[model samples]
Target: MATTNLNIRTDKTIKEQADQIYSELGLSMTAAINMFLRATIRTNGIPFSLTLNEPNQTTIEAIEEGRRIARDPNVKGYHSIDELKAALDV
Candidate 1:
């Protein structure tokens, strides 16, 4: 099979991490990329599912509220599980 070079831009850290993973799997970067390309061609598209794993608006609002409470000095903090359980009356 005739092959050509393929250049792609990715973060340095991401490349380093991928390199480690490929090394552990007994593959080079080129081999890993070729496998991905072949899989893509076989599937007639991307070989893996791509979707947003984002939190919903209500969850986002709750996370922000929790952060605000954490930053507020007036908010009560329980130091132990027993204390938390007592506060919750459980």
Candidate 2:
């Protein structure tokens, strides 16, 4: 196989962050980029989801309420699923 060079310019901070993450994942930036490109060709697309699946306002409010409940020690927490079900009178 023959090889060639490809150069790209990216934000320095982003590149540094990506390099750190790739290093931790046992890949160099070059290897990571090649993997992404190969996957793109294999899948005939970006090879990952690019769409936003954000929750709506009501769902966001409910999620926030759940978080609040999770942080409250006064609210009871069951040690087991059965206990939770029993508390719910299931």
| lDDT for 46 (candidate 2) | 99
Off by over 4 Å in 1: 54-82, 85-90
Q: What is the TM-score of each candidate against the true structure?
A: 0.61, 0.59
Per-candidate Cα lDDT values, in order, are 0.97, 0.97
**48, model 2: CA deviation in Å?**
0.9
TM-score, cand. 1 vs. native: 0.61
Model 2: lDDT equals: 0.97
Runs off by more than 4 Å, candidate 2: 56-90
Cα deviation of 46, candidate 1, in Å: 0.6
